[model samples]
Target: MIYFDKVSKVYPPSMVALQDISFTVEPKEFVSLIGQSGGGKTTLLKLLLAEEKPTEGTIFFESVNVNDFPRSKLPELRRRIGVVFQEFRLLSNKTTFENVAFAMEASGRTPEEINRDVPHVLELVDLVEKANHFPHELSGGERQRVAIARAIINQPDVILADEPTGNLDPLNTWEIIRILKKINELGTTIILATHNKSIIDSLGRRVITLEKGKIVRDDKEGRYVL
Candidate 1:
């Protein structure tokens, strides 16, 4: 569903974030990107998300050349992708339910659809009971689950979670991983980027290791070996 072909991303000041990285993620696959800091994993994601352009080569979402996508269609493309960050980017003033609802409203979804889908997604993340709570009123784990709920509310085809468990304790980390596993089981392609060795090792899935803007290894049922 996603392909990066000889893609290189360079920032100003001659900084190369990714160097000719190439990979293909089949539909419904759960892939882990394990790498040290500044290793181009996030850079590759930015390129795929259309937040940044590749300096060389190309990126494709399905059969469409994402690098060449028309500017006007970016919102449509983003609607197909769900992103979760280490820091849950919830609105401070909005309740958990509203936070997820706002995402759908931004995409011009109808009120009927938003009302129907938001509750279902919150339930999926086990946050239905906390829907009325504000960000500060919830625990860190609950907040992250709200973020995940918001990401999946639109039923996006791919979920990009970068360091999702970075801020949680071991127990909460496991909770988040389980939630992600559930989402993957529902057939959403999942791409997880992290430096956490233990979490990656416990997953025992396809692991890709990156170093200094290049991928060094790609394996199935892999362990995190930095």
Candidate 2:
């Protein structure tokens, strides 16, 4: 449902975040992006989300050119995609349930819809019992689960997860991965950008490796070979 065609992003001066990168992610597919620090994985995700424009080439979400979207249309584009970050970007004052509900609220969802969907998404992430807890009250894994719950609450078509397990222990990491896999199984396209070899290796999914801003490998059932 996403396509990148010869896309490149360059910051001021000589900084190149991505160089001539191209790939396609089909609906309901689970894809892994693996690369070292500053290797352009995050830049690729940003371009897809239209947080940054490509310096060259184009990015397409379904058939619409993401970079061509006007400012007013950004919310509409973003609503089709969910994002999970390494740091649990939850509001400190908001409870877990409220954090998940906030996305819907921002999108102008009705109170009735928020009430109905928040609980269901929390259950999907196995955080139903902790819904009333704040981010600090939960463990690292629980916090990340809350983040995931929030991301999926709106049922976005694609979930772009950037190092969602980076801060967790092995057990917690696995737990997060399991939740992501479950979401993928339930028909959400997942684009996971991570540096964890063990997670990538174990996933055995489509692996796209970048080296110095270029795609070096694109393999189906690929292992983490950096």
Per-model CA lDDT versus the true structure: 0.92, 0.93
Q: Which whole-number lDDT from 0 to 100 does residue 11 have in model 1?
A: 96
Give TM per candidate: 0.97, 0.98
The TM-score that candidate 1 achieves is 0.97
Q: How do the residues 94-130 of candidate 2 rate in per-residue lDDT, one tens digit apiece?
A: 9999999999998999999998999998888898999
Model 2 is weakest, by summed lDDT over 10 consecutive residues, at 118-127
Best by lDDT: 2
Q: Tell me the spans in candidate 1 whose CA falls farther than 4 Å from its real position.
A: none
Q: Local error of candidate 1 at 112, Å? A: 1.4
Candidate 1, 95-152: lDDT as tens digits: 9999999889989999999989999889888888998999999998999999999889
